[model samples]
Target chain A: MLHEPATPVGKDLAATYKMRLGVLMFLFYSLFYAGFVAINLLNPLLMEVTILPGLNLATVYGFALILVALIEALAYDLFCRRKEQTLNNTQNTQGEGN
Target chain B: MTIIIFLFFVLLVIGLSLYLGKKAKTSSGYYAAGGKIHWGVNGIAFAGDYLSAASFLGICGMIATVGYDGFLYSIGYLAGWIVALFVVAEPLKRLGKYTFTDAIDSKYNSRGIKLAAAISTLVVSVCYLIPQMVGAGVLVEPLLGIPHGWGVVMVGAIVITIVATAGMTSTTYVQFLKGGLLILFSTVLVVAVCVRGLTTQPDQGGNVPYYEYTTLAAVNESGQIKVSDAGWQVVELQDIESAKLTFAKLAKDGKETWWLVSEKDGAVELHETQSVVTTRDGQRLINGAPASQDNQLRQVSNIEKLRGASDASTGSVSPIELLAAVSDKDTQINLWKEAALTDKDGGKVTIYYQKVTPGNQVMRPGLKFKVQGTPLERADFLSLMLALFLGTAALPHILIRYYTVPNPASARKSTIVAIAAIGFFYILTLFMGLGAMINGVLNPADSNMAAPLLARSFGNILFAVISAIAFATVLGTVSGLIVAASGAVAHDLLDRFLNLRMDDHQKVRAGKISAFVIGGLAIVLGILYKGMNVTFLVGLAFAVAASANLPSIVMLLFWKKTTAKGITASIIMGIVSSLVLILLSPDLFKLYGLDPATAPIPLSNPGIVSIPLSFCTLVVVSLLTGEKAKALKLAAQQ
Candidate 1:
């Protein structure tokens, strides 16, 4: 059975993990948010062009959302695996101290 | 065809529920499918339970009426599943016993946590259930010509019986069945669309010219306006009368064919008018206005009328010529109302609609969102978008699905599957909506009828199957919600908080009873909130869920420093604040159309402001109370 190990952090590890996670989350959320804002703002403009044809903002946003979600899921899995590896290494070092 | 298929499918669902009820003898068996369902089946069931009537019906309706904007909802909904898969799924499955409260109280053993979590679950689940019930009512009203209220009651009774008898076992199977049927049939429908191909000419089926009568002053030859005896009706040279036009039949072609009216001395002449008007903006104003209601003048019939010279049956025109012939500028019909003529009863009597050329303003978004003399309504639009994006992740029924799976791995896998299924379905929505728009099956009376009516165009059998699937979609979702609420009441409140110490069998029985009670309440609310958009109601549910449950769950999961007091405070505050904000919002005021002072708040969704507030309260209170609680616990241990 694989068990999660608790590592004693000297503040640095905790801060680093927190900062990395926060940045990643912010980036992921912001990308989607930017898409949303852009579509809502530009939709009306797109409607103004006579030859271009009316575009459905929802369909475009939906496609963007699916793509972003796929990327975010992949990023999250990678982060978790990396974090797990670090935690495992720390546990091994603490066992040597004991 | 619609009635027979709908009844047959509903009966099959009910029969399956009854069978599952008998098998679900234990509490775990009833509440969480004995926590032993296959990941693959549960994944599809997740799709079934998640894709409610709102997704299938409301989205298609929105697209038919509002064009591209309607498809945006599908994107928001599917995106929420990503949050579920990575953030909540695994940890939730690992922590909770049977209910969401179990997860929170497992670490703390606090009565306050149990009570707060239970309350939040009940509130969110109930809010979610109302829309399903409303959708059920809407479906039944059109299918059987019964009142919407009766439909709500019937769905309520059926769902309650299902949940009360079998619990999650029944709910899962029903959702699984529905999920499979929905995907299979919708795919078939999409293929049908590809096969039918896009045609400019109207099919031979009976088609009506889309008409709207606007009232204006009517003038005579001498420029004298003709007035009725009551002085309400005026017959001017160019009189316009606005009449509330109801939809009779869908137009066969994408362009409406009309007999242009030119009146002289109240005598009318009919001229064949056909032309497609394009707005200066990119929007293709079919006849004269926006494709649908948001723009005043655009009208596109389902199929365009084929000219005599271009008739393919006569082998007179090639396919390219057929397309070109219908696309010709002269092939569009534009209708404008003359004037309002009032009768002796003080009511508008004579109304005239004349075919004319459509103008540029028809294709643009009107002044609805714009404030007078102010900048664009960015704030209001942003707030709404935020509410939609965040609300789905916070919904209680969705959150509870994590508990239904056995392990975190399964939960994660299920969420991924759900996202894939939901995403695909959303893609289909574009075609479905466009197909309905061009096929001439859109119900002007209700946009919600788009998908089913679209099916009707193919034949009665397809219509019956589509309608049945739609009804089943409502049933599956409503059952899941009622089950969630019932579990909250029985397991969290009675067993945990009240300290009943009941066996699994007793707990299951209690849950069943609660399901009936809550289901009845949902029916009443659904009937009261009729004629409103289901999608908007769903937004409200998401807002409340995000505000009430999200803070508590997030705090418990990440912040070890969080105390019993902090969790309780946060849950109570989140629920109260969000509910209070929604009740006071502009929607409530506008719904009543009365004094703003009488209403509590000006905003419709509280997620924009209330979600942040809840998170802040949790953080501050946790920091303040954590140390003392830990010290007390250490002292006790010593």
Candidate 2:
């Protein structure tokens, strides 16, 4: 595909970076979610233990999943922004040299 | 008063639709809101569209009845948006102009791809529509004093008006309005739950049961209901026309009692209630009053504090304390347990009994999805979860929302906003459900009514507001689905495949006509599926979408070698396989008034099998065709 030259150069750059980060976050989140489900399947008794005052492990784990989603969203946005900035800086420098 | 508020909300929404309709002269405006919606509003609208009856009414009811199992749905639904935000939102917006099918057909204007994708969209959208319509019917009976069928028809008419008038623009605003109000009012209800706190306090104001029963000696026209001290004589009966099953009042020694009668062979038998009474109107009341809105039980029952902390019933604990207290093993909480009882007619009627469950057990996962059940049952549970987690990003209606934004970045931003709003709302459901459980406000017949009934426990005013908001929730979701289905029909099927060569005006007109047809279809299905749990129906839709649509969409975005033929084949495989599996699944058999055990398919959800099947179809076909064919097709299109 690269030799064919049909694809844009920067398109792969952003796509690669985004895909890598996105897959990583997705896998990481899935592991946590799977853990919750696995625990429910394997030994549901663990969910009964109070991890905090007035809160059980199951409830805490559920809320933690939501927090993790928010954090991942923010992290992805920042990472993409930085990548775009780097790409723009290189283009500017090349233009100046020309 | 409730009716007045409901009327106001309905009129306001209809008026807004007509106002927005003026701008929908063009197909772009009608289909994608002219790609002019603000990212912020669109994000909230996404939440509105996604929440539906399942998230608001279904999850809460599940939690109220079963405990921690319901929150799992919230987690699965929200996790799916992460896929949308990180992977799908930007790419879909960049690719498609109006509809989700456009994103795929953009590469090659293949009529096969258009036809297959359009059919899948319609199937998934209609499956999704059934639950929303069912939820509307559930709300109508209790809130508007109307029959369930009328409520479904009312929703269909309103949704058609909205979709046919202004299309996406009207849908978006209605979604945005309802979404914001749903979150706001839910927070109010959650706070009220917190203020009221956990209580083991028995209902004193309403008709209180004087005795509890383990069993009855006999039941007939002259059958006797056994009490601890003495027995009662059978009186008038209801629902026993065939002399199979009935509710009756028994008068014994100047005191009256309620008994459930079961007739077997030539003999009549009686089952005594745990707590029951006979009202002046000869109505058999359980606990205190009949299981109607007139019941005054307004607080959580069968409660206790942490095991070692105190044996006494803790009164008015804080919200956090309430949850923590329920997690303790010693805390005796009341939860509903359902059992299917065989009536005299040999049919099954599922009856829910109030059980004194330990808090530790309630907080655990085994109550609903029992691991101890058959292997197939356990597999079905996992399949349901997988579908829910994958379905959100694949939904035709959700995908179209991305095109409503200006750019890929806006699409990404709006999705994140959706996650935040939706996540917050799901958390509130736990409290609302728990509140409903303790408050004795649940309608024993319909789990869908738990959230609204919880509000009614606060007062009629709050009930009116929540019910109206819930009605809007159904309307917004149903309208969005109808619009998506109509687009698939008009734009993808007619214009692209049939080569109708429709102008913008003709396209909009065709779409509107399609909306009316699909809306009517949804209304009919909803009435047919009455009394079924709304949330479970949604689970089926998710499974279908995950199986049929997700594989093709994901492969198209990622794999360069994915041919139009591969895409077409995969979609057909996905749709056909999932539909066949679902039709053969036990649950559908149960719906058809057949024995569930006789169904060939073991798993209820088709995602675990059909999703992988669809993926393999896409890959195998792509590999067989090789990349050269795709390259030639692309060149030809250019």
Candidate 3:
């Protein structure tokens, strides 16, 4: 025997989630582009101390770039999820009123 | 003993490969280690796969010889990973099957996308593989004292065997091993550098003496010259006093110790006490005055022979007094003219003294070639930088690694881990390069040998370890590239394009055969392109990947308007444009010094132009053909 599932606000929430994700994705790319330009300008000074044995500023910066990218990607994912939840709650309230 | 250690390392690697090969029973297992690898393990392997021979050897050599500009490559390489993590990693993992083609063709059942992607994969993989093979050849030269061609052959055979036997399963494990060993040993070397401080010594032998030009004249009592217009001559100095001196003195462990020294004038001087007894001029003082015409000037025998007579009364030579004696510019022990060439024939040739000074532009890029009235030759340089920046994410071998992990989360974590490991190793390379430069062990003929030779300075034991690890690093990366190429050939081209209905066993067999064939081709290309930098070849691979595959993948995922025809056109355009541009670029002319006049293209990398073009082609074509595509999709669903 199949059990009936509880009603969940679905299509409206999905649409809002997609829109919010699209906007966050735009911001993510924008931030990375800004960081890239900033780091590119500072590369010369970083290279100066790179002559020392064992410490390389370029490699350190590479690690920093990866860390920043990870944070941006995760934040985008979370923002999309939260926006989807908010839209789902709004759709549920509207359905009850109707 | 070195050979034994090397053999032991090789045996250990082979054993690990066999163990992993046994576990690769299924097609998925063979292709991506059953997609069960931990992010931490895969991440380190990613570091292993990315570092390659270029990061470990070429960067160090470049830094030692070229100075700051060499480190620029390392910066560009690291920055590219940002593009990989932020834009490519999670989405690529979430997309389709074994290859990047799978992802693009998922939305549209388009044969055109598959064909274009497979061809692009082959081109990029072959290009990327060449440098790893070349690195293998370079490593074998010093390790076995064999010819470079033999080294290429050996690496090709080994990588093919590994790829053919187990594919990605073995490839991943090998890369993980290499990544761990590289980081661990490099850290040990760095600690050694910190522990052993720089020092100096007098009477240090075995160093080749440097020669400097000095003019000398012989004068009689009437001031007549004995010889005029002499050329350069080699002279041995009993002692040299400099305000700044960089040299390596031997330490207690037999490793060379590097030092930088500076001394003030009047604090040091060379006091020659030997009196010359020549046939032309009997017994004359030679320490305080310049040599007279008849007085023969000979190099002093020892530091004792250069001791000042006035300082003899003081009994012991103080460091300050020793410095003061050598710093005296007024005292001249000997004066001799350098040798010169004179042509008596109609050719009219004579050796003349001229000062040489390197220009400021020598350190900057674009000095060798320039585009007049433009800032740093925008087209060629920008193309190269763009290729480097975008290429890592697009690379087939790097892309396929994402599939080796379980899910998108693992792919993301692995990339982060890779970034950390790779970043740390690159940091070590800078020090290793500077250390090699000051160690006085850098080979003038080859910059690629800098890291290995630097290790050699510490002892043969360290040298053997580093060289073996380097050899293993090449093997791991090459195996990974071959596996990716083989998968594209067997899975995408043979199965999907040809519509071959084969059992899983047959597919694996075909992939193995393809791996062997591609591995052989990689060897030939590597041998042909010996002495060129490996990093540049990798950049070319990236350019092709970004231009050809990236646009199609991104469009299919995001654009609802994308059509099969649009993707096909985009892939074909991306592949054709980037490859054609690279083949005709000035780099081809400069690398082999081919005539640029005949070259059809001007830019080396097409990413700056071709990437945007591909995206636009997809969009415009999709919009125009959207209704026709809509009907086709509707009918297929029905």
TM for chain B in all models?
0.77, 0.87, 0.74
Better of 1 and 3 by TM-score: 1
Docking class of 3: incorrect
Per-residue C-alpha lDDT of model 1 across residues B124-163, encoded as one tens digit per residue: 8877777787788888886788989999888888787778
Models ranked on DockQ: 2, 1, 3
Among all windows of 10 consecutive residues in model 2 chain A, the one with the lowest summed lDDT is A1-10
Candidate 2 segments exceeding 4 Å error:
A1-15, A88-98, B202-228, B233-316, B340-351, B627-638
Cand. 3 TM to true fold: 0.70
Off by over 4 Å in 1: A1-30, A38-61, A71-98, B197-376, B593-600, B627-638
iRMS per model, in Å, is: 10.3, 7.8, 14.1
TM-score-based ranking: 2, 1, 3
lDDT of 2: 0.79
Superposition error at B321 for model 2 (Å) = 1.3
The number of the candidate with the highest DockQ is 2
Give the TM-score of candidate 2 (chain A): 0.75
> Over the stretch B207-249, how does candidate 3's per-residue lDDT look in tens digits?
3232222323322224222222233111211112321221111
| Model 3 ranges off by over 4 Å | A1-98, B194-373, B376-379, B595-600, B630-638
